[model samples]
Target: MFQDKGALISLPAADIAKVRVPGSIFPAQELLALELREDLKAAVRLIKDICEDHGVDSLVVARPEMFTNGPTTAWLHNRIGGIEDHICISDGRTVRVVPGMTNHAFFMRLGVEKNFERFVKLQKRCPELIRGLASQINSAFTFPADASIPTVILQPAEGLMNLDPAFLPFCLVRHSVQATFDQIALSGKIDLTENFSRCSRLIYVPLSEIALQSEGFCRYIAREIAAAFFDPTVGVILALPTAETAESDMKAGIETLVEALRGIPGGIPSVASHRIVLASQECPESFLFQGSRRVELVLHNSLDAWLHPPEYYGRFDHIVVAASRATDTRELYVEYIDHLLGRRPEFYWLEHLALHPNDTGLIAAW
Candidate 1:
């Protein structure tokens, strides 16, 4: 029932002091003249007259600290407005504001039962739960024989070109959830490719040229891995980028691609068939499983693992099983990796399925 332009224009305190007169701004004459404007209505009329005379748009008053007396306290408790109207007068012309935290606490105290019931409704209606609902609705998901876990690679494509590609995955997760909430329900298909593809950084070079640079090559691999993850129709594809690209450009592409897949609400089971690959060269042989890469970084602090994963493992059971089985937390996982095999082996794959519950759920019951 309360509606306006919904924009607040703030005038500085200095400007307010220059224009306002203490008590004369109120509609004392009009309130006395009009019989109908009594009690709470009289305060509303006073606020309107002040807005008209003093050009006072909106005023946000912070509460004075405990055991302190100030002009603000007197102005607030002087009964110029109604206790029911939050000790403020509002007739669309002006709003006498109070500290939001104080207002919230006061209202919560007055309507505890109503507020509690509304909180329960909020939990049930949370938009993030749409992901869970989407998960429940789409039950058709299966795993490949080797049980390689599905992964989504996200990269910056267009508008997201400015953002670090590595961050795009988390952004995709958040944005897709938001989109689901906006629509009030999950759709059969969620597309976010166009929005992510916009970027200022792009380059053109031959595939062979890019392969010469290891960093650029690794980045290209990240992009290919991201693209392959989202193409539900194809389990894997080995195609060289016709043009050479910067590591950042390739990363940007991967960021957007992965974000699109990650944003899919309820989860896209089709991604399960795809195994992530970031090899320098595309092996000519067509195969589902050739090998996977495991990256290990040694950091003194646990902060890096949370903020920036030492190695971003895209749910590879082969890699995760060994890591998860060895440690309870990510910090421990890093430590376990550090302690393993003083002499690093040519192939990092391990044979143990130590069988974590979440891992077991991912696999088909034998």
Candidate 2:
């Protein structure tokens, strides 16, 4: 809507009909209202028509591989003054779009060399920009990193311990404050409420508390996590480590504990014959764990580790967390930023960090 390339582009009616806009600072109702506004509708129609003429027939915008720079997408976004989110669907296709600019670019356009006085002057003149940006900040939680795939995130702060046994296979909320452990009692062999009491009190527990937690508790939680992953029907396991501990410490802890899980008598190894694949930032490694020679290891410290397709890495039917509570407070903020960038959460929720990669001076999370 913001651009006028004069090239007609018709979108697949089906794809346009399926486009979902999540509730951000604005609620779903509010976003719908805005979408229905005369101006926006007109803009969208024009944009759609332009896209259709250029053979952009579907809402599916062609994209480069995840993490690989898309020259065309970037060029279009820069000219159009907007950001576009591709919603991927099954069959390895992207058929949905969330498009908007959060005014981040405006401030960024001022350049690092700009003075604080200049920012103050600019802010006074751009009242609408300020208001719009504020709205964007408040609407963060509505949309999550595209749920097009059956991907689930085990946040570091709240591992599989926070989830009920029944919902282990289903998707979960981003924040644990929402209805996580509300219905704790279940008629299962293990009393989930009884075992992980300390872990479930808050979204995140300190490292000291984690250390004090019983091995039985860890093992029990681990067992349940393993059970969720190794369902006999499941093909491969994607183990994503979300712990906020030190890089070395969290990596070592996860690798060791997972190995232990495999060795646990009657645990995952006994239940399923799926391979466990881990993404690391370093080269791939291999080792025998509990007599199962079905683990594929690779280095992928980037978030892309979790975002990439299962088949690209190998056989994988489900993704589970090797998640632990983040130990570092800074990691919490970094985690939020990652969520903001990947999922486009409301901005104000993370505005405190100034979106500065190096807000801590010494510890920049770029």
Candidate 3:
């Protein structure tokens, strides 16, 4: 296994036994309060165990993106008590706050720009994901109280409709199917023009758009994408790096992708077994071979050329394209792929599921 200096102590599956907390203890008004209470207890226990085992006195907990100015901080403080002073909450940036301290005080004490510089330095030495996940397993217990944390929020330039052209062919296919069904109803005759037996799913990742984002954000997005459709059955096509893509960005993207794959429940072994098609000009050696596990990467020069003979013919049931915009070139590429596939793409609603709103809009625009 590839190891990072800041890696968290691995939480074994066998060790995570379910604790059945009685529902009667929780208020009847809140349906999930009991479950939430149990989960929090488990998280606190895990944190305490890890801290004791490492002989660590104070720790910084990275705030998850979801808990924006929520009651998580108060809830955690209630459970952990005076130790809240020892626990600092970070928003994956320069902003770090203790339990009672307001966001304004923290920023006023440490200037925004200076804090960012310090954060950059800290990031260079340690992986943010490790630090973040180590303290809080799934969700961060702390929430940003009053300060608006400046973080990059990547958004697709175009609406969902114009994002991927691969769905165009699928739309046409569906229209045809509907028309055929209408004809059959009118004439009372069955006409099977197309066979809807074998279907394939295409997961198109817009690498160019996500390349420049922070490594933490990249990992988050990669994990979300993988969780949604990282199966052997799905056909994934990651768009090639654009001219504006930086080498560091590509490296971060690749590393985060691998991390996301391995970070999932089953780890590298489960990911390595999946037959994923990575459509790119060249495959990076680091991505293909991570420690002892080898991932079989299928590379192609251009989307146009790759779809010429359609490697996995009549095998795609879903086509997922992760792009910021449907550029003319990208549209053409998707169109070509759709043409080759010769099937209607089933539209799966995936808006705002993978990428969430962030405060760093200006940075992302730049």
Candidate 4:
């Protein structure tokens, strides 16, 4: 069943079902011929066993998280904490089981130093690494060969772990494109198309701290780009605070987001509550509105505000455009990076962005 110059990339064969999955590449065709998830695992095992029974060396398995979860619907995001994926390697003498991280580690070998701070746009920042990650997952649930089982017992026994902070951010980044489109739908001021690529159109611009940042101008810039590239409907998602956010020594995060978002053309701004105290009792979807037309807030509660789940973040197309609202650029930059790293995305489809502290509303976004 082997051929030359095909999409399926095979590695050296090994004896006993011992399979070694490569990180960046995997056997996609072999898995898909089978239609069931559980059967998919069995097919993988069968292939490995066939190679092993033939006295082959071992099965090289390359995996990714995207395959397993890409088809997954927006839910509690099971990837948060549990065995989302796994690979079973069995040699005539033994079977070794491994989790998805093994594949991440595989890609990491050829991986570049990803300083999330430096990545202004997700894909623009690191596409190959990300693509490799997604491909692995796709390979996981590949269709099984015909006659595959239809039960969970045959699924790969990859032990799961609590979803990694890095995992959620990465997932959110994947959905960033969708979030942008959704933002347009919710704002209602723009008629944006649903098709968008994460980072392909959106870019993060971090700047120095400055008081009186005018987000109004920032929206104009984002609109100009959207109109020029895709459509005038192209919208921006920002996370900044009110300029008057008065906390000299301490950072006023939500307030800053309010200001940056306000800078956008027809952007609605709101305060994120703190200390388990909701700034409102509704989600941003309820309070956020187009222009000064404020909608009824549905999730201003302190608890939800504090949680600020990642799904909510994905519900809109926005950028992490921060203005320090700080008088000093140097100090603001330091605090800004610190906050970006400290705050992981509440949803799997969004990632933290690095914005400047001194940037005035519009100026900072640029």
RMSD of each: 24.5, 19.8, 19.9, 20.8
Judge candidate 4 against the unseen true structure and give its global Cα lDDT, from 0 to 1: 0.26
lDDT of each: 0.25, 0.26, 0.28, 0.26
Ranking by lDDT: 3, 2, 4, 1
**Candidate 3, which segments miss by more than 4 Å at Cα?**
1-199, 209-232, 240-253, 259-270, 282-359, 363-366
Worst 10-residue lDDT window, candidate 2: 104-113
By TM-score, the candidates rank as 3, 2, 4, 1
TM-score of each: 0.16, 0.21, 0.22, 0.19
**Model 4 agreement with the true structure over 2-112: per-residue lDDT tens digits:** 111112222212321243333334344343333322222434454344334444322233422223443441221232222232333211111122223322211100001
lDDT of 1 by residue, 311-349 (tens): 222222222112112122344333333333222222211
Task: Predict model 3's lDDT versus the native.
Answer: 0.28
Q: Which regions of candidate 4 deviate over 4 angstroms? A: 1-122, 135-251, 261-366
* Strongest candidate by TM-score: 3
Winning candidate number (lDDT) = 3
Give the winner by lDDT: 1 or 4: 4
